[model samples]
Target: MTTEIGFVFAVLGITIALFISDKLRMDLVALMVVAVLAVSGIVTPAEAVSGFGNPTVVMIAALFVVGEGLFRTGVAAAAGNWLLKVGGGSEVRLLCFLLPVVALLSAFMSSTGAVALLIPVVLSMARRSGMQPSKLMMPLAFAALIGGMLTLIGTPPNIVVSGALKEAGLEPFGFFEFTPIGAAILLVGAVYLITLGRRLLPARTSEQQTDHCDVPGLMASYGVSGQLHKLVVQPLSPLKHQTVVEAALRSEHRVTLVGIRRSGTLLSSILPVLANTRLEVRDELWVYGQENDIERLCLSHRLTHYGSPAKEISRMGREFGVAEVMLPPGTPLQGQSIKEGAFRQRYGLSVIGLRRRCEPLDTDYRETRMEGGDTLLLAGSWERIRALEGRRDLVLLQTPAELGEIPVHGSRAPLALLVLAAMLVCMTAGWLPALTTVLLAALAMILTGCVSLPEALRSLNATSLILIAGMLPLALAMEKSGALAFVVEHLVSWLGGASPLLLSTGLFLLTSLLSQFISNTATTVLIAPIALTAAQLLGVNPEPLMMTVAIAASTAFATPIASPVNTLVLAPGNYRFSDFARVGIPLQLLALAITLVMTPILFPF
Candidate 1:
């Protein structure tokens, strides 16, 4: 290798190591490599930073707005209703119809987007049908992963692969070239999975219950602690006219009000802090009652409770309680031990059990790495858990029933879909660049108030942006350093006389393994350059090889650690860490075999 190339390779290796190890952010790592390249005269600084301005970035940013619009306007929800209506009553039927819809949507939308839309609908339907939310949520998430493979814009990995190939001077793939194999894998695989997965799938939704919790009964069950009983004020009742402090003495309740839940929102009430205002309807009021009078007050109000309502509570030391909180994605808790999180002290709760995506908590949760989908099995006072829910990692998971006349939402639903359809048609007709069509539609969405600017910003995953932007420089660094060629040559030689097909398959497998360990996007960027070089050295068309790379990279279905879809299911599926190996291992192997076989058939080397 040339001295210049050797230097580039060293920088590439270091950048990738820091990226995977997470010692540095991917963008920062990419920046460092770009800087190194410029210093070594491999590429000008202008060239290094220019990739950040690529139209792909603009299109992606706009898509986030579009996705947020669909969600905000309830277009996705309307679509979900129609889709589920068609799912029929049988589990297999639901899986067959719903999984394909999820996959197809995921092809152009975010997998998370698909899940966010589907979960609520599934949860609501599950309750109505006496079906399990757990049974459906995981399939929805998995379908998103499968469907994401259908188009270049479906998932970031597809775009990344196509861009990398384009840089190598190959004809970039058309919007639908991927559809033949991708759609086949999605359709056939969804069918195969619906059949086999039924027996293996569990029916657990962390909080799916026959009754929408009776707040009064729930509060009574948790057992009052420290002479304090937690409760919410009935709207426009006697308590509504008085402040917490005034209510206690005027009513001779002598209760120390500490918190309040109002209009389905919980707020901390400082009797002394904000006591001047009159009590409002829907406030979750936390009051410390006298040990003797507490029972009397409960009887007068006809109050009910959730945990052993019968148990008498005297002080904080004598009582513990339960509260339900939802886990959000990529939280620091997403893959840490409960012990490591210091969750016991942090939240003042025992690490009891978690309700994830509707599944019960597994036994090994203390040692089991916590991930986004698992709702924590918290044993503590309602006060503590309620406060904790306000944190970024958690959602209070409260949905009010008896909502009357859901404000007959306007035509935002139909209008949003129309806009999206028009944009796609324009893109297909080549009337606009894919970027322009998506961007214009996205801008129109913002104007319609379907999604506010703040919401759009929140929807953008900063980590994802950094990862994608950083990969550009890293790929260039690998190519410039000649390190990519070295790895390709050595890896090819190591496989020694393996047929082109077999070698391509082996490459796919290796990439798949790496993707399972890290972000699939990172895996694609890290290995794709090498695959291209390998294909050239082998005297074969690089199309099959590239297709193999794309397929291998996207099949991160086996471990919660491997793919977000699996991780999303871990808690909701009430899955053990090893459950991925049990269920996912087989699915993964199947995905790989299908992709390897299909890639060559569709795009011959």
Candidate 2:
């Protein structure tokens, strides 16, 4: 039995390690794990794969579509602009202006994604105004995180918390039940960051860090898909010596010319140098293959991968695929993560890309958070995309509906507010189910053509849908194996009858650590149920305990691994894995302390 247990544990551990490593794609790993556990008899294949179809998972994807509409209408974009402009002076002025905006926007959009969109915007502003990017980036990251806590749909943690509550027979959280306290945390965090954070942070500007990595010279190097490179030669490359046809003759290996890297120095005076540019040894080649292919090709003939070869793909676009969408006013998705609300079944599209706009406009492209004015990069056809008809400002990149169709751009801002207010009222007065009310608003948007049904489908997220559905059996396995309970029993014993304060602190720290390694939703899913069980065993209202876990789970401020938004920025920001830690460690510690002190005070024993 112990051997079997060890085998299961080994498989689970390796699966989790692969997820954290992100070397193999997450979905592939999940599928592999499903097969492994099923073959191992830990679960049947059908049971292992059941999580892929959860309604909640579908709703999460749908929520992303709704966010797409909000982004298109310039709602989030406009708000982000207002925040930066409002912060236009001292760092103190900036945080005062920025923090609330970050929190408010994050209430409806992705904190990590929102921050990625805002970072470039804010950094540009900071540079223009003589402010340091270093000072602003950390604060920006923290604001995005705290803002996530403001609404049930704001972040995965809140959604997981709500799901756990429902599982425990208590009501799931309303859209803004935690807002009052969340706002407080935002304020306190902003104040803390503005006053003291700037002092300790590494003062690196976006320019200082990116474009030119440590391996500099010969322009920029990109992570190629395969070992084969597809580099374009600049006029600077001695490649100007010969024609493309001639270069192909001179090269031993078959050199296929595919694309051209426009010479930045020559572009000012000339047209874009097409792939016709002659080949020089130093000319940029975007190799199609990677590692082994490069080695074999290079060994057989002669060619370098680039000035400096990268072991992995860049962070910007490679971590995950990206998709784009437009938000029309009156859409219900304006304020949520796909996980909380579920968009896969609600809408048909899957979101893999995102973009946002702010002053000095981002055009909000590619992995940008759900700020208004974001042009989401969705993976769907135009027939599917054209469904988002009446979105205010967003234009689908892949136009299928009415290519020339302009959004109605009504005063849905007010209507949106009213809808939120009504949802709050329903939650407070017990007028309707929160999910039902939110779903009604979504349905109305579709029916009214504010967001066309096809458009809704275009905005759904396929990866998240798979994530939620695929991972559940694994979560269930832990429970059925008595793994979670056993872990909890040992943890309680480890704590040694600790006080609520100590337990809260412990839970917060542990969840934060877990979040850094796993999906925030995954972290919350496992912890929330455990927290409730622990509270019950300890004779306490599970509210505070659950809240502790939820807050900690969402507060993965220290690593890109902590949140998807952080990962989105990894490439664009030119950040290394450790960079997240540089900013995250202090922020995590402070957030943990705050959670410890605040949870018990607010929710009480």
Candidate 3:
């Protein structure tokens, strides 16, 4: 090998080591590869950054925005809810219904997002059916991975391989070229998971059961269930016509005014409890405090207490919700009390309950000093709670199920669907490039109010986009320095005269093995060119080989760290590392056999 080739391989080795070690962020490692290649003269400065402008990168980014539109407009959640209605409480029936629906959604959006959108729904299903979450979590994750094979935009690997073809001056794979092979694998994989794989999954209940609680369960866990009371302001009450702040209920009476219901309005017309919200005669007030304190407040103010309004509290949850949040390590709020930090003013949320080390704090928790790992139960509008999701200082541990049922833009679902269909139709008709088509669809989603512009921007996964962009230069460096050719030549020689099926088997094993450790997208970026080059050297069609690389990269099973989707289900599924291997290894092998037998027939090597 030449000096440049040797140096390129060294960089590749270190990158893989960093990825496997999981010590540094994958995107950071990718950036290191770009910097080294540029400084070492392996690729030009412009070429080093060329990946950001690649059609593949742009198309993938646009796909994120489109997917977000579906999420925001309730298109994906609707499908998940539909699964519940059809599957009911039968584990077998739920599995049969869930696999296809999740796969179909993953075929169009990010597989990770598809799994996230359905996790709570599945958990609800498991709770209602009295089945262990483990019975369904692994299947949910596996089907999502398999679903990516259905469309070119389903996963990054598919787009990367297609982009490789285009870069080689070949016609790219069609939009649905992967559909036939993918459908067969999904059907077979679904059958395996529903049968033998189901038997392999663990039945242990989740250790962190507190992490998935509904509104009632959350209230009960926080010891707030019996503290809620409804009070009607009598005409002679001193508190009538006094604003919430003027009443000083929390400061003097040790009670919180949760909300106020006007005397002559529908139950749904309850008004939010702001500091300036004034009380009037016969107005029903939702108060939370100790029974004695609430009684004293009622007697002193001449208010009539109506006991706990369980039904009204349920109705209030439609407009206001509760969530659990924790202060992550190194948070700025570490040393200050909630009152001192103006928590309500800052986040528009009230800390109604606090827990330290899994034990509930005293009711007078407002003055308690904040510490890392302290959990707080916050009450606020669902919008405010959702806004806390991506903040650095606070980690949102659990959101009530009510949040999922209320879509931010539910009325725009039909518009979002129409835009998605148009984009797909335009791409299949070859009337526009895939990138242009995707960009137009994303823009339509924003313009039509299916998703706002800021939401679309936030939907773009920065780490994923940066990782793909930074790693593209390394692939270019490998080809430019003849490193790829050198490796491809040896790879062919090592398996000399092997039949196409045997060759594909070798490729599948290597790709799938590497994917278990590395980001599948990065694995594909490095392996696809080699697959293409080898096919050229052997004088055969490269389509089947390219398809092999794409399919293999998605076999990120057998480990919790294999894919984000796997890790997502880990805690909720109550799974161990071995649990994945027990199920994933066999599934990976099954996928391998199917891909080898099917790709050649469909793509014609």
lDDT of each: 0.60, 0.55, 0.79
Tell me how many residue pairs clash in candidate 3.
0
Over 1-605, each residue of candidate 2 has an lDDT whose tens digit, in order, gives 35555666676678667765667656566677777777777677778877665555544444454444443333443444455567655677877777777677677755644563355356445533556566676677678888888888778788788788887898677787777667777777776787766665655555434432221111111222232243444434444567544444213333323233343222111001322355554444443333554455554435444623443222111111212455555445555543332332333344433334512222211223354444443322233345554544445433321122123333454444344345345533546654455466556555544455676786554543454455566665765665555655666777637776777877787788767655677667777876787777778878888887877877777765455555434433434445567667877777777776677787889
User: Model 3, which residues run further than 4 Å from truth?
Assistant: 73-76, 84-95, 105-145, 148-181, 191-222, 226-268, 272-316, 323-406, 410-414, 427-430, 499-501, 507-586, 596-605
Q: Estimate each model's TM-score.
A: 0.49, 0.48, 0.60
Clashing residue pairs found in predicted model 3: none
Candidate rank order under lDDT = 3, 1, 2
| lDDT for each residue of candidate 3 in 191-246, tens digit (9 for 90 to 100) | 99999999999887764343467766777778776777889999999998898778
Off by over 4 Å in 2: 1-8, 87-98, 101-184, 191-431, 497-504, 511-585, 596-605
RMSD of 1: 14.2
TM-score of 2: 0.48
Q: What's the CA error at residue 579 for candidate 3, in Å?
A: 11
Candidate 1, 32-145: lDDT as tens digits: 665666676776777677556766555656766776677566555455446556776566776777887778777876565455445545554454345676677666766788
Best by TM-score: 3
Supply candidate 3's per-residue lDDT for 101: 85
